[model samples]
Target: MDSLTADDFFALDLPRHAQLIDGTLIVPEPQGNFHSVSPYVLAQGLRRTAPGRLRVRRQMCVVIGARDVPEPDLVVVNASADGGPCLMSYAARDVLLAVEVVSPDSEERAQDTKPRKYAAAGIRHYWLVTMDENNRPAVHTYELDPHTGSYAPTGIHHDRLKLAVPFTIDIDLTEIDRL
Candidate 1:
């Protein structure tokens, strides 16, 4: 079969998480318990802490290339994205941050593919969250180095996640347990 364009993938009427990467359609498997709740907690935390000009959304698609649209666990974008008609997907350039709560099924994509794509598309911030041995959220953050058009390791937070770039972020990852 032929590869699907981003438009082709997005136009489809589907009810669950999906992405178009390298011109192919990808439907992520149903998330496990932690996977389901962590993104929600993170999004809520960001919404409360981020500057008012930014907006936080859960599981929104970002268009990185003509055939690449990845629905990150959460996306942070400038308020301008909200001023228009409700968007089906936000352009990569409009995204301030792309976050992934890595599930077992998504480790490879979250750690590698998505970051590479995000950096190449000029998305300045990328974060990957995974459960530590004790089943706590460990946030790994990266910032784009425009000179090289690649991401640089910013920090890794264990019990709590904090950052200065992309707006001051302080999230008690433990909140994931409340769900």
Candidate 2:
């Protein structure tokens, strides 16, 4: 069989949550309730606070390479990349930030694989959300280090997340409990 390509990945009738990574199709297990709801909550917070020049979306994939298209929990892109209703994904250059809400099942990909790919794609920012000891949201932010083409830790937030880059973003992590 031929290896899956990004063009083929989009053309197939696959599950909504499926992803194409390194020419392989990966269908992750159904997420836990908290895992399932994290993106919605985070996206809601971002949408409400993001500058008009940016747009927030949930379960959107960024086309990083010919064989790499990983769908992140949430993606923030420039308003021009919104592409209206027909567009299914955004080009990597258009993505401003790629966010992954880490679940037990997805930790490896979220923490390692996806970040590497996003950084290589020149994405400006990446956010990884995980649960803290109290089972509340903790966001780890990273910015691309242009010299190395890798992400560097910017901050780790528990009670609240405040960032000036990618436009001002302030979120109360406890909001995850509402789910």
Q: Each prediction's Cα lDDT score?
A: 0.88, 0.89
**Model 2 residue 160 distance off true place after TM-score fit, in angstroms:** 0.5
Q: Per-candidate TM vs. native?
A: 0.95, 0.96
Candidate 1 — what's its lDDT?
0.88
Residue pairs with backbone atoms closer than 3 Å in model 1 (clashes):
none
lDDT: which candidate is best? Answer: 2
Model 1 agreement with the true structure over 89-138: per-residue lDDT tens digits? 89998899999998888889999999999999999999998888878888
RMSD of 1: 1.4
